[model samples]
Target: MGLRRLAAGLLGAVTATVALAGCTADGRESACDSAGGIVECSPDQRSAAPKITGELLPGGTYDVANQRGQVVVVNFWGSWCAPCRAEADDLENTYQATRASGVTFLGINVQDSRDKAIAFEEGRVSYPSIFDPGSRLALAMDIPPNTIPATVVLDREGRIATVIRAAVKQEGLQPIVERIAAESPEPAGQR
Candidate 1:
């Protein structure tokens, strides 16, 4: 059983890397019409993002529940997925842009390793990542193994704002994030 879990983790990591790569296609020429089988963002499909627990690298545990009142962009990815890698830079860039505004990006790297995760974030991506090797979190989110490189955006109050199971472009992410970051709860004194 232990061995099986380890294998699953490794597989998840590889898949995430590939997904990242596919998301990196040139934004100017991105297939806005399609994501090569991946789903594009839309209101009907903008379901609640999944929430799960994970192990922070170098030994720590964290969960999205801790991020209430702040907008969170949670991404499920693997090291071997092309689309995930493709969007790494954009993810990093957008995260940097929104962090100051109270938006945070949480990367849940599945089937991947510490080394690869390190390299991916150190180079261009700049967000804290958690490991989901056993896949309890991935399953909770209903993420198919092949349909990875997925992203879930949380509203300011921590409700899932959207789910994008495609090659995420900055333009696609920018507007939603901006909305979340600027979203404010109604004043308690108001009716």
Candidate 2:
């Protein structure tokens, strides 16, 4: 099927009660990003993944700071976003399936509280996520704040390999992941 048809097909099959403020192309940025408010990233998103830290959920103790030498996938979402809810399963599946390949998936729940975010995960998603309670991180990144369901793929060397600004499928994810795994680090003792 064509891209349009595939998108439509998938959209129709997915069910979500949460209200999506706006939608992006690949579910990485806020679904509602107006081309006008969206600012481009330095070195672009395909360059080195910027060094940053995010407060973890559950207890909010550990902060996921670095992405060096690992393929990190960051998904920006919120409990209020329908599309984000729709992609929850796919994201979890990707996380579980890609571990051996040295890929790590992290979620950034933009503009959401801990309770709502946790409910979303336990009820539907199985991956780990960070709660961006005050929109601080979103503002710092210069992305349109509250744009649920965006994703950023960082390469093994910590470079930004790609950004999926809308809902994405498994096929759309493999190529970049493959390339990242090719350069992934082996055990410390291994050559």
Candidate 3:
């Protein structure tokens, strides 16, 4: 689909009550739902995964465009997001087990100060994460405004294959990543 149409569709979707603003017991923003959870894009509905490039938490830069031909897992999270913390270990474990299969994970940290975010991932998580102090990367992914702890799995062609809203579990995510990683590249012009 054209960018205009995509934008329009996303706009329409956004109006459907994806997130509500509230405070958790800890006084952190509580974001829930993804309008309706994973927006599945048909083959015809596929769009190139948004280009992502930024300074990683520990060091170096990460560019999503460079991950073409590999299945890429993009997870949006924040230090203050309780669900993010709940799933962090599961995500890291999945990453470790799947790396040999050519699956890569990129965490996008949003709405947290650099120090706190880095501290959150320093020892418990092993994957590199983009420190998005602002929501630029989230906006690029067309994430519903204010939703954190969302995950997007990109197919080998770099098109978005699946999106998971809310916290992710290993049981739910492993099969999806394996399936994408195992797919043979589409023939020329077939993608």
Candidate 4:
């Protein structure tokens, strides 16, 4: 009877531990739901994205926080990455289609020289890209872009709504951007 009692206690403890693993320290659900390489979070489940401010390749500064009222699509890329090159046009197309709806696209060029990165962008994309040879900005994200051609979509409230950890095509990415863009912005006073 003592052996049976111990076994029951151990099983209960294991179950509780597994359940708690999915919760944050403050008892909120931890991390976004991920499926087939795409990670998504509901508005209430989203956490604020890390501050992203940097120098643009051509010349200018950008602060993601300043784009609160717009849905922002951030892409992490490198001039030498084949996948990044392959997805460039698709990203530009999606950006053009969604920009009228208050959607903005920003790229972070990682591990590439300014001249090379600029050449890669010439005529490929209209949106501005930040010059980040060391990938500091990418590393700062809550869900860091572990891959060279990752994309993160932020809601109007500046919270991370979706993360795609691979090259994205226009057909696959446009719907996600449009869905997030459709969400109503928070009241000015609430921000």
Candidate 5:
């Protein structure tokens, strides 16, 4: 009976491995999965951005909950992800342009060692990134299951307003932030 149980467990593990192996054409986890398959979350369907407090890469602590009353842009990235690398400058540029309008940006570094992630950010990304090697932040936000280089825009009330499942560009991000920032917060009771 024990042998049968062991065999079944092994088969299950193998089956899961095989299933995940084909989850992507390159065998890499898809960005959509990390983002919870949600391309966009409407204002009416918006939920609180997950509470993720963590140590920032270089140093300092960040509490996502404290970012209330501002348009918070949460970006999930990895040091090794090509799209993350490609979109780094665009994010920074947009942040610079939109910050005065009450927009803030936070980055979550996942699936990377601290050293490599820090090295990648050195002189490239100006915004702070939490070292979420296990993707805890992404999971907390309920982003699609396996996507990287995902971006989520949270409204002033810290409610999720949009989710972008791919690399973000300056042109695409700026207007979104501007529009969200321009809107007045929902009434206290409405929120």
Candidate 6:
């Protein structure tokens, strides 16, 4: 059973890497670089993020399209995941520090009851989260956050810029958020 789990985990990682390669039509090299589980894409290689609209945890509807012209950080998490709980405060701190620079953080709670997810976020994060019990939003992403605690950073133009497939620390995530936020909103000429 343990060996089967290991094999499944490896297969998932390979699949994710292939999916994220983002090769161009002309067969150009992949525009993404994966190092230490963090995948960063060059501005010219990014593709538009899929539309993500969902119900907010407590109330109201949230739409990712409305956040154009801002660097958006989308986190996929579940209340039952230990790593999700461990990174909650760090995610919140990074959001608070980068919001002034046009960065916003959105959480997608997956595979958990509304009550538990809401309880988990009570004092840990100030930003609103979408209730995604079925992971519909995750499936819609260009680079899906397949792992709990994964984070995808969208550039100002709502393009996938970076994906971190592990629980993040404020120190590491804040810099990436700030850098992407500093990029110009003008679309790059190269595809």
Which candidate has the highest TM-score of all? 6
Residue 100, candidate 4: alpha-carbon lDDT: 98
Task: Write the residue-wise lDDT of candidate 2 on 1-191 in tens digits.
Answer: 59999998777656221223323334434322234323223223333344446667776533445546667877888888888877877777777778777788888877788888888778666657776777565544423333556776666656445556676455556564666667644455642
Please write out the lDDT profile of model 6 over residues 1-191, one tens digit for every residue: 99999999999998777665533354322457778878888887777888878999999999999999899999999999999999999999999888989899999999999999999999899998999999988776665566788999999998989989899999999999999988876645644
Ten-residue segment with the worst summed lDDT in candidate 1? 24-33
After superposing candidate 1 on the true structure, give the runs of residues whose Cα lies further than 4 Å from its correct spot. 1-51, 142-146, 186-191
- Could you tell me every candidate's TM-score relative to the true structure? 0.67, 0.64, 0.78, 0.82, 0.79, 0.83
lDDT of 3 by residue, 42-124 (tens): 44555566678999987789888887777899889999999999999989989998989999999999888889999999887
- lDDT score for residue 139 of model 3: 69
Better by TM-score, candidate 4 or 2: 4
Total backbone collisions, model 1: 36
Q: State the lDDT at 21 in candidate 2.
A: 32
Best lDDT among the predictions, by candidate number: 4
| Residue-level error in angstroms, candidate 3, position 87 | 0.1
CA lDDT, every prediction?
A: 0.67, 0.61, 0.77, 0.87, 0.79, 0.86
* Candidate 6: residue 4 Cα off by (Å): 20
Clashing pairs in 6: none
Candidate 2 worst ten-residue window by lDDT: 15-24
Candidate 1's TM-score: 0.67
Worst 10 residues of 4 by lDDT: 20-29
lDDT computed for candidate 3 = 0.77
Lowest summed lDDT over 10 consecutive residues: which window, candidate 3? Answer: 22-31
